[model samples]
Target: MSFADLGLSDELLQAVEAAGYTEPTPIQAQAIPPVLMMKDLIGIAQTGTGKTASFVLPMIDILAHGRRRALMPRSLILEPTRELAAQVAENFEKYGKNHDLKMALLIGGVQMGDQIKALSEGVDVLIATPGRLMDLFERGKILLTGCELLVIDEADRMLDMGFIPDIESICAKLPTNRQTMLFSATMPPPIKKLSDKFLSNPKYIEVARPATTNINIVQYKVPVTARKKREMLRHLLRTDNVSTAIVFCNRKTTVRELAKSLKQHGFGAGEIHGDMDQSSRIGELDRFKAGEINILCASDVAARGLDVKGVSHVFNFDTPWHPDDYVHRVGRTGRGGARGRAFTFVTPEDAEAVQNVEKLTGGEIPLFEFSGEQPAEAAEAVEEKPKAQRPRRARKDEGAERAEAAPRQEAKEARSEEPRKERRPRRSQPEPVDDGWNGPVPEFLHVSALV
Candidate 1:
């Protein structure tokens, strides 16, 4: 069904159409209706299934007439990461444009003075990360007592990042009568318990299985060593028909090093990680979305909540520490029903990690062979080939030495015969009998020194 059929405001529907979305996604189609009714909801869908809009669109229609007081927001959205919080805020700006609604984003790595000012003037919607929201609440810069709507996006990610306790505290502060919507890619025990404690008979809506990879993506795991990962990745980037891609590294340093290395190798690449400031991360992402860079080398946390369309590939430079992250990383591609490719680099040490990821996906990811030379076999065979050639040359040199030595023996025999003949001539009659014997023995007895 279209966004219009979901009971969205005409202004919001206009924005949706302007954004070129005619039909609602599965999560949006299912969860948007319940959310519009102000019912507590639990939306379970894989990443990149338009889950953010499922809540954001309906909330705009609900909050269009709400009265916001100073230092008090009418609605609050709790996101686990800065990227996700910023994305939700962007969604509000895009879809809630035709409607009159004030939304403020509270995330780290930004000036607090502006956030405080925005909170003091009051906002119709407050989209914030857990830590920043708590920080503002502690400073008495914002109040949630008047908040009528609460959205907890990426609840499983909250558990992964150790934000569960903070989420619980934030949930406790909000009015119990508020409408709440909880969305997660997976339903872990902690997320379930937290939902039971906070949500009031929520409508259970699941669009897909938990921890499942998108079927549109063709995924493969390559058996590669740490040293050859960069080489193999470069080969794939050059050989594959990639229009745009994300290379996911596990560490911030790896992201920096890989991006730098790719640039040095003449690839249009950029880097983003948790350690970077908010502006730098946003700049890189904007550049990537605009097609200024075809490849983005980023850490998993920084890559979260990025919704670039038509990413041709996703490369896992290093195996993730958690199996659930495998789903999230690959999900960056294959978005909005587009087909894509995902490649994961697996070393011997990463066997267990790859296995865990496969278990989560319910099968093994097919192996992808490099088109270039195989490292291990090529190294051994290349070494043996040179040694085999050396022996043949040595044998030929020995034969040449023997042939030269044979000619030297003939010269020595002639010299010895000359000495015997000279002695016989000088000794007159006494050397006459010995001369004949020496001449006959000369052919059979010969000693030669060869150098």
Candidate 2:
């Protein structure tokens, strides 16, 4: 259905059309109507399902008539991360172009003076991270009592990042009569409790299964050693004809390392993680979205709430520790009705982790062998060194002169008549060689008898 059928104002529809969205996504179709009707809403959809526009369009229409007072916004959107909050602000700019809506962003790692000035000028919409929002409230620079509408985007992510308590405190400060909307890719129990506590008679809209990956994405598992992940990623990027892709890693260290590795290999790549400064992270993302970079190596911090359209591929350098993250990581691609590809690298040790992910998604991920490649006949077949060529020093040295001379040298040194022999050597002596044929000794015998 079109935005017009969703009961949005003509101006909002015009803005949507200007933004080049002719059809509303399923989440948008189901959510906009109830939200515009001033009902509390709980929207659960996978990532890349156009969930942001589901609420942004309707809220812009509802907020068009309200006038905000200084330090008091008429509407508030609480996002779990600064990148997500900034993305929501961008949506407001795009969809609210026809309407006169003043929005201010409050997130950490930015100049507080600029945010304070914006808040003082009065904002119709306030988009903020939970921590920074609470900071402003505690300093008496922002008031929640005047808030008429509240949107908690990525509710599950907030819980994952330990922001639920902050959300609860903010909810307590806001007007209880305000319209509340909570959106997430998954609905964990804590998120449900938060929704129950804050929402009144909420309309539940779920477009996809919780923690499920998109079907449109062609997913594959690329078996490779962990140490060779970067090389394998580079090979894929060079051979797969990727247009724009996001490479997800489990750790911030891996994100940085992979991005640097890609850059050194002449790939147009950038990195984003929680450890990065806000400006650098945003700059990298802006470059990536503008086609300045073809690859973005990021942690799960970039997985949720940041919308970058036309991503053709996703590569998981490290299997996500959380299965829900696997869904979101792959969802970064295959967005906006476009078909995409996703490849995840898995080592032997990561088989159980991949199995857990498959269990969570309720399907077996197809194992993809390198084209024209076959499994080795045995473990030794895959080893670089031939078995016959492997060093046999232990067997060769058995009963050799060095072995016999070792004990004789010790005895000779111990029986020396030199007065200096009374002083013990500070250096440790060599250990006796194990014949490799005897059964393993008890731990206490090895420890006490050896000493």
Candidate 3:
């Protein structure tokens, strides 16, 4: 269905059309209607299923007529990461452009003064991370009692980041009669418990199974040694039809190293992980979206909320420990019904990890048989190469040199094998001494000499 059929206002529809979205995604088609009705909702959908627009589109209309108050926003959107919060803000700007709505973003690694100013002047919507939101609330810089709408996005990520307690506290401060919505990629036990405790008779909408891999993504696992993972990745990037891709690594160090390696190998690559500050992360992402870089090496931090469309491939440099993470890592690709590919490098030690991922996805990923000689066998074959023959006189001269040098080598070895004893130094003869004052020697000196 189109955004217009989703009960969104003409202004929002115009904005959405301008943003190049003609039809609503499944999640958006299902959730936006309930959201526009001001019902409490529990939205369960996988990543990259247009979940942001599911709420953002309706929110712009719901908040269009709300009155703003100083220090109290009309609506609140809680994201678990700075990037997600910023992304939601971008969506609001994109979809709410036809309407005039004041929006503020509160996340860490930025100046709080501007956020405070935004809050003081009163904003129609506030997009924030839980930590920064709680900090601002405790400092009495913002009030939530007047908030009429609340959206807790990526609830599972909130659980992962240990923000449930903060979420509960924030909920307690908000008006109980307000509309609330909780969206998550997976409905784990903790998030379910939080939803039950917080949401009041929420409408449950799930477009897909929890932790399920996207069917559009063709998944494969390449059996490779850890030392040859880079080689496999390079081979795939060179041979496969990769227009843009994200390479997932479990550790930030690996993300940095792999990105550097790819750049050195002449691929347009960039790196993003938790270790980078907010500005650097945003800059790298901007470059990626602008086509400055075709490959992004990232940790699991980029797995969940990042929404980049038309990604041709996803390469997992390391198998994710958490099975659910496998879903999100591949979810970065195959977005918006586009065909995509996912290649995971599986080492001998990662057998269990791959098994867990397969169990979660509910199917086995076909192994990608490397077409050429394996890395180990190729190296060994090169090392075992035969050498060319030398002249007979050269061989004879070599043998003669060794024969002549053998005795000296044996003598040196024998000397080194023997233990040496400590020797006493020889004493030197004493020299006769002459006194410079021979003519007038002191009486004390004469007595001393005689004694």
Candidate 4:
């Protein structure tokens, strides 16, 4: 069904049309209706299924009629990361343009003066990370008592980041009678408990199974040695006809190194991770979205709730440590019903981690062979690569030593062929045998000298 069938207002529909989204995604079609009715909702859908818009669209309309108060927001959205929070705020600006609504983004890694000033003037929507929100609340810069609507986006990620306690505290401060909605790709027990404690008779919507990867994405696990991961990645990026992609690394250091490697190889690549400040992270994302960079090397910070359009590929430079992250990392591609490809480089040591990912997704990932490399005789032996040879410097050093030893060996052989002599000569020597002197004895040893 079209978005019109979902009961959105005309002005919002016009804005959506201008944004070039004519049809609503499955989650959007299902969840928007309940959200418009002001019901507590538990939306379970995989990443990149239009879940952000599902709530953002309806909330704009629901909040349009409400009056905002100073130091108190009419609606609140809690995101797990600064990137996700900023993304939601962008959505509001895009979809809420026709309507007169004010939104403020609250996140760490930046000055809070502007945020405090915005709160003072009052805001219709407050998109914040839990930490920054709690900080402001303690400082008395913002109040939750006036919040009429609440949304916990990516609740599982919040759990992973240890934000559940902060969320509980935030909920305690908000009015209990307000509308509450929780959205996630998976429904873990903690998220369920949070929903039960907070939401009242929430409508449950599941577009797909928990921890399931998107069907539109073609997935494969590449068996490569740890040292050759960069080689394999470069080979794929050149041969696969990638338009835009995000390469996910497990560590911030890896993200930095990989992006630098890609740039050195003449690829338009940028890096983002938790270590970067908010402005730098946003700048990188903006560059990626503006097509200035085709590849984004990122940590798990960008894995969840980041919406970049037309990403044709995702390369997992390192297998995700958390199985659930595998879903979101690949979810960056195949967004909005577009076909995409994802490849995960699995080293021998990553067997357990890859297995956990497969177990969570309920199926084994197919093995991918390099374009020109010969397939192994046995698939199970894919990880058993030949040992790497010694480095060039070590080999060169050994060659130099061998060349230097050749002259010494020849000199020693020449000396061995010659007659051997005593290391030192005696001070005086008697000539041949028993008193028969073949050579003169020393004068000092004579008996006449003694007399």
Candidate 5:
């Protein structure tokens, strides 16, 4: 159905049309009507199902009539991460262009003075991360008393990041009669408890099963050694005509290292992670979205809530630690009605992790082989070779052999000699005690003097 049929205001519809979204996604179709009716909502859908717009549209319409008071926002949106919060803010900007609305983004890694100023000026809409929101609330910089609507996006991620307590505190501060909406790609038990606590007779709308992957994405796993991952990634990028892509790593260090390696290999690459400053992260993302960078290496911090269009591919440079994270990583691509491809790099040790992901997705991901690569033969050859012929000895014998042979014996002895000084004994100090017979002692001394 078209966006107009969803009971959105003309201004919102016009904005949607101007933004080139004529049709509503499945989640949007189900979510918008109930939200526009001012009902509490619990929406469960997979990533890349247009869940962001499902709430963004209705929120813009609902917030259109209200005027914000100083330190009291009309609506509050709680996101899990800075990137996700920024993305939601962008959505509000894009869809609420026709309306005279102001939004303040309160997240970490930036100066809080500006956010405090924005809150003081009375923002119509406030999008903030749970931690930053709680920080401001506790500091008496923002108030939730005037908030008429609340949206908790990516509820599961918030729980995963250990923000449930903060969310609970924030909920307690808000008016109990406010409309609350919670959306998630997956609904674990904690998330359910959260919904049960916050939502009152809510409309439950689920577009798809939890932890589901997009069917349009062709998933594949390329088995390689941990040390050979970069080489294999370089090979894959060189072979595939990757127009634009996101490469997911499990750690921030790996993200930065991989981005550097990719750039050194003459690829247009950038990096984003939780460790980087907010401006740098946003700048990198802007460059990637603008097509200035062909590849972006990032941790799961960039996985959810980012709406970068025209991503032709996704590469899991490191297998996700959690099964749910796999869905978000690949879902970065295959968005906006576009077909995308995702390739995951799995090592021999990651077999169990890969199987768990497959079980979570309820299907086996197709196996892929690099062209002109001889991994099996190489492995077999290494296995067939005699242990004595191997260049590096097994780890079990490494330390023992070193200890026995003592090749660096002289150096070891020299090092030990410098530290032969023993620890000094602590000196005992005398304790003072009160004598009860001070006057008797003075008499005894006088008697001795007389003697």
Candidate 6:
């Protein structure tokens, strides 16, 4: 169905059209109606299904009629990470442009001066990470009493990042009569309990099954040794006609190292992980979205937050440790019904990890066969420096040179040293007498008696 059928405002519809989305995604179509009706909601859909827009669009219209107050926002959206919080903020700006709505973003790793200013000036929509929100709430810089609508985006991610307790705390502060919504790709028991405790008779909308991979994504497992993962990734990148891709590594160090390795091998690549500062991470993402870099090596921090369009491929350089991460990592591609491919590098040790992923997705991923010998350049890329030393003839000549100097050294030593029998022994010192003090007499006391 078209976005018009979803009951969006005319100005919002116009903005959406300008943004180039004609029809609503399944999640958007299903969740928008309930949200506009001001009902609490529990939306479960896999990644890349327009979940952000589903809530952002309706909230703009619902909040348009509300008056904002100083130190209080009319609506609030809680995200798990700074990246996801920033992404949701972008959505609000994009879809809420035509409406008269003031928005503020609250996240860590950035100065709080601007956020405080925004809150003091009053904001209509506040998108924040739980940490930053709790910080401001505790400091009395922001109040949730004026908030008429609340959204908990990426609930499972919040659980993964240990934000559930903070979320519970934030919920306790907000007015109970206000509307609440929870969205996630997966619904674990904790999330279910959270919804039951907070939401009141909310409409449940699920576009896709939990932990399911996107059907638009063509997935394949490449069996390679840990040492050759980068090589296989490089090979696939060259042969598979990759346009824009995200390469996910399980560790932040691997993300940095892999990005550097790819750049050294003449690929336009950038790195983003939790270790990076917020500005640096945003800069890398901006570069990637602007096409200055075609490949982004990232940890799971970017798996859920990135919403760049036309991403043709996703390469899992390391199998995700958590099975849930596998869904989000590959979901970086095949976004918005676009056709995409996902290649996961599976080592012998990753058999169990890959098995868990398959089990979660409920299907066996076909093993991708290498057509021929490994790529020559790829192999060279990961090759260790040669261990061979200088030639044997040079070593032999050096040994002869040492042998010639040995006679001179022995003659010098004979001249410099006295014969062992003529050498005198070192003198032994006498022990001090115990004269009541049990030690040597003090020199100061031996000053001939200052008398």
Task: List TM-score per model, in order.
Answer: 0.83, 0.84, 0.82, 0.84, 0.83, 0.83
Best candidate, lDDT: 4
- What is candidate 3's lDDT per residue for 1-451, written digit by digit as tens? 6677778888887888888889888898889888888899999998889999889888999989868999999999999888888889999989888998999999999999999999999999999999999999999999999999999999988887789999999999999899999999999998999889888899999999888888899999877777778887887898788999999999999999999999899999999999999899999999999999999999998888578878999999999988888898999999888989999888778989988888877889997655665556324322444788776753467788899999999999999989988687755534435856457544454333322
lDDT values for all models: 0.88, 0.87, 0.88, 0.91, 0.87, 0.90
**Ranking 1 against 2 by TM-score, winner:** 2
The TM-score obtained by model 6 is: 0.83
Q: Which has the higher lDDT value, candidate number 2 or candidate number 3?
A: 3
Runs in model 1 lying further than 4 Å from the true structure: 369-451
Better of 1 and 5 by TM-score: 5
Tens digit of lDDT per residue, candidate 4, span 175-232? 9799999999999999999999999999999999999999999999988777778877
Candidate 1 lands at a TM-score of 0.83
The regions of model 5 sitting more than 4 angstroms off are 370-451
Give candidate 4 regions above 4 Å deviation. 373-451
lDDT comparing candidate 6 with the true structure: 0.90
User: Which pairs of residues collide in candidate 4?
Assistant: none
lDDT of 6 at 144: 94
Error of 5 at 428 (Å): 37
RMSD of 3: 8.6
Residue-level lDDT of model 2, residues 1-451, one tens digit each, is: 6778888888888888888989988999999999989999999999988999999988898988867799999999999888889888999999899999999999999889999999999999999999999998899999888999999999988988999999999999999799999999999999999999999999999999898888789999877776676767877787787999999999999898888888888999999999989889989988998999989999999888557889999999999998888998899899888899999888877889999999988898886655543333212223445447666565555568788889999989887955664766455534546778587755554343333
**Poorly placed runs, candidate 3 (over 4 Å):** 371-451
**26-89, model 6: which lDDT tens digit per residue?**
8889999999998999999999999999999999889889688899898899998888888888
